[model samples]
Target chain A: MTKYSPPLAERIARGIGHLMFLLGGTWGVFIALPVSVAIAADPIQLAIWGVFMGSGVVAAFAAWRGLYLIEYATIPAMAAGTLIYVAAITNVVATGENPGSGLALFLMIALFSYLTARWFSLNQLLDGPLKLLFKRRQGLDE
Target chain B: MSIGTVITLIAAVLGSSTLAAIITAFVNSKRNKSQSETEARAQYTVEFNAIVAQQNIQIERLEKRVNQLEKAEDYIDVLIAGITNGTIPPIPPRI
Candidate 1:
C-alpha cells in the first residue's frame, strides 16, 4: 500500500538503533581526542593514546557511511582495538598503583565485546534470509 | 595518581567505546541491507505468482473455446449430410 509504507514501530526501532550507533561513534572520538591531548607528556603513552583515539575517528566515519558489512568482516579488527585499549589502561593502572582501575578497563572491554558479538549475531540473522533470496535471484538471472 | 596514568586510563576507555561504536555501525548496515533485499524478493514473488495464475486462467479459457468449436463443426457436418441425402428438406418452404 502506498508503495510499501514502513511501519511506525519499525521506523522508530531503526531510528533508535542508528542513534545508538551514532552516540557510540561520537563518544569514541569525543573522549579519545581530549585524552590524547592530556597524555602528550609521555611519548610512548602519547602515541598509545593517539592511536587509541584515532580508532574512534575511524569508527565514527565507518558509521557515518553505514559500512557495516566491513564491521561484520573484521572480528579480529575489533579484538585488536579492544586489546589496545585494554593494554593502555593496564599500563596506566599498573603505573599508578591502582589495580582497581585495571578492572574498569577489563569490564568495559568485556561489555563492549559482548555487545559487539550480539550485534553481529543479529546481523547474521537478518542476512541469512536475504542471502537465500539473493541466490534465488541469481539463479533466475542465469 | 600521576597525570600520565590518568590520561592513559581515560584514553583506553575511550578507545574501547569507539571500537564498540564502529562495530555496531557495521552490523547495523549489513542487517539493514539484508532486510531491504528480503522485502524486495517477497514482493517479486507475489507479482510473479499473480502473472502465472492469470496466464493459466487465459489458457483454460482458450481450451474451452477450442472444444466448443470442435462440437460446432460436428453439428455442421451432420446438417450438410442430412441435406445431401435429403433426409430432411431445407425447412419445407417455411409457411
Candidate 2:
C-alpha cells in the first residue's frame, strides 16, 4: 500500500481547495450564463461576459492550486483577462459605440484580482510564513 | 451572613491576597535586582572585553598598514631625492 503521509494542515488545505474549486465552478456557470444571454444582443457585452467567465474559471483554478500547494501560484490569467477586455473595448471604440460601464467593471475586476494575487505572493502569508512559524524543531526530528 | 455576603467576603479576601502576593513578589524582585544586575554587568564586561579585543586586532592591522604606507612614502621621498641628484633616472609621475 502507498504511504499516505501529509501533515494534518496540508490535508485540510487541499480539502478546502477542492471544495472551493467545486463551489466556484458551479457559481461561475450559474452566474455568467444567464447574464451573458441577457446581454447577447450587444456583441461587446457578450464578449465581456465571455472573457469574465473564462478568466473567472482561471482565477478559481489559481485559487484552488494556491491552496492545494499552499503557495501563491501564477495569476497571469487575470492579466490576460484584462487584455481581452481591453481588446473588446478597443473594438467598441473603433466602431464609435460606447462600450458601456459593464465592460469597464470587468476590466477593473481583472486588474484588482491580479493585484490581489501579487499581494498574496509578496506577503507569502497563507503558507510560507505560517509554515515557518509552526515548523517542527529539527532537534526533535527522529 | 447570606451566601452572597459570604461569597463577596471570600472574593475580597482572595483579591487582597492576590494583590499582597504580587506586592511581595515585586519587593523580593527589587531586592534581588542588584544580584541580577551584577550578573548582567559581568556578562556585559565579558562581551565588552571580546569587542575590545577585536577592536585591538583591527587597530593593530590598520597600524601595520599605516606603517607600510609610511615606509613606502619614505622610499618614494628617497627616490625623488636620488632623481634630483641625478643618482637615479627621473620617472614621470603622470604614468
Clashing pairs in 2: none
DockQ of each: 0.04, 0.01
TM-scores for every predicted model: 0.32, 0.29
lDDT of 2 by residue, A1-142 (tens): 0122234554455445334433533454455533323322244434433443344443444343332121222233233333433444444444455546456656556654754565344233222332333554543563
Docking category of candidate 2:
incorrect
User: Tens digit of lDDT per residue, candidate 2, span B73-93?
Assistant: 877887889878988855436
| TM-score, candidate number 1 | 0.32
Q: Which stretches of candidate 2 lie over 4 Å from their true place?
A: A1-74, A99-142, B1-78, B85-95
Candidate 2, residue A94: Cα displacement in angstroms equals 3.6
The window of 10 residues in a row where model 1 chain B has the poorest summed lDDT is: B31-40
